[model samples]
Target chain A: MLRKMRRRITIRIDMTPMVDVIILLLIFFFMTSTFREAEAIDVQLPHAYAGVRIPKTGVYHILISEDGKIYADNEPMQSREEFIQAIVSSRATNPNLIFDVKADQDVEYGVMLTVMEDLRRAGIVRFNLSIFKEAGAW
Target chain B: MAGANVGGGEGRSRTGRRRISIHIDMTPMVDVIILLLIFFFMTSQFKEPHGIEITLPKTDVPVKIPESNTVTLRVDENNEVYFNEEPVEEISKIREYLIARQTENPNLVTILDVHPSAKYKTMVDVLDEFKIAADETGVTKFSLAMKREETAPEGGGG
Candidate 1:
């Protein structure tokens, strides 16, 4: 008499390569990602082809809304004098402070010149005008 | 010599010092790494911090620029563009004019004179054009004109 025999085979796959790739991607994202901060005012920046990538720190923001209201570092200023005073006082502490003007697209051009003149009076000769990158403008 | 060989060459003693096969499960570690990766990937914004630079002179002293090497672009309230005080019907004329003028004269000084009521977007658009022209000519000389009391009268063409 003969007895029938049954055998089982197990297959294993190597997950090392997949896990290694995931870890590499994880590190890349962790290093390059920056959390977005909540903005005090919503500004619709205009598109421009010529601009440089501004740094994250050591800069001050002068925001102008579409309604022609100005804000210094997110604080609404009643007049241009207050804005100048704020910049002058801030410059007293940090001489290397860079002024960044973030104005809405609908804002008047005259308002920008006024802000720039005020910045010049506050001893700020060089400043940045923030703009969105136009894809095909270059 | 015979006593030295008694236990030194035993195969059982070598087997006793063999390294143990310790298998560590990597499923949990990989799961955590994938979770963190997803979180970062979702929250990351690909926005480049872009801005246009403007540098004003420290002193208010006005420097004289020759008319032969000067180009003034003036924008009005209705986003109408003017090239060298001449109203341009087609905006592309300004770009072509800038490129041609800048190529002809490297020392060309471009002035921006914008009316107060004009939209800010128009100024940036014109500045972008100037930049493109400058890149081709390898020279960039521009200034923001002081505030004008009133808008320049519109003309048909020059």
Candidate 2:
């Protein structure tokens, strides 16, 4: 009697389903992910009903805290001269640059006015005062 | 785990009876995907903040401001609010006054004369009131001005 011995078998996996699921997940993430501009400091904005949506591009941010500290693009500056220099340099690159002044509600009006004066002396004419919109104020 | 052994060596011929089966565990993959989904969801900011435009008055250039169609709202250093030369007893009165003024002149412009020493909160509150009034009465234009040099009245009305 002759006996037949079975050869060792190799198993294979079809990766089509796994690849399909992974690709679907990749597409979902790509669709849902949002790329937002970086904010250096947080501010407690005043609420108003006449607030408008400011343009996202071509804007410079000047943040003022309650204690009269000034920050340009999140970097604290020593004097108005520093602010003027920064604005001049930034304005050279983008002529249409508009300043977005965000001042805390508790800050004295004089501090804000002085900042605005410095910006104006730097030749920045167009700017927005950042404010949060009050709900149901339309 | 229940479907792990469904297709284990069932299609083998009699000669190849000893067969091996392959299984891919998807629990770890699903866990990773869910973690990534949560991470993306947590870091994303969906809404943009709002703002109101303010043009600073030029020190060198003097422009004539028309007084005919303008309503002046002043906030003194003591935080007393005056609407169109009249003292406002309550903040809500600003809305009512603006509505009445809007009926008389549709193209009215509001000028805010804020004192330098005035509290920023008071100015903001007044601005908020103006905004509410504008929204209710359909007045679109407004401006901020520095209060002219004048002496405060005796015994300050707070």
Which candidate comes out best when scored by DockQ?
1
**Candidate 1 residues A34-133, lDDT tens each?**
8764567999999888788888888888899998899998999999899999999999999988889999999999888789889989988888889998
The i-RMS of every model, in angstroms, reads: 2.0, 3.5
Please write out the lDDT profile of model 2 over residues A16-48, one tens digit for every residue. Answer: 587577758666766965656666666777767
B60-135: candidate 2 lDDT, tens digit per residue: 5444545788788888888889987789888667877887887789777777778878877677778777777766
| CAPRI band for model 1 | medium
Off by over 4 Å in 2: A1-38, B1-22, B56-59, B65-68, B77-80, B85-93, B119-121, B131-140, B147-158
Docking class of 2: acceptable
The 10-residue segment with the lowest total lDDT in model 2 chain B = B149-158
DockQ values, each candidate: 0.64, 0.36
Residue B129's lDDT within candidate 1 is 79
Tens-digit lDDT track for model 1 on B85-125? Answer: 78988765577899898888888888887788999999888
- Local distance difference test values of all predictions, in order: 0.82, 0.72
- lDDT top scorer: 1
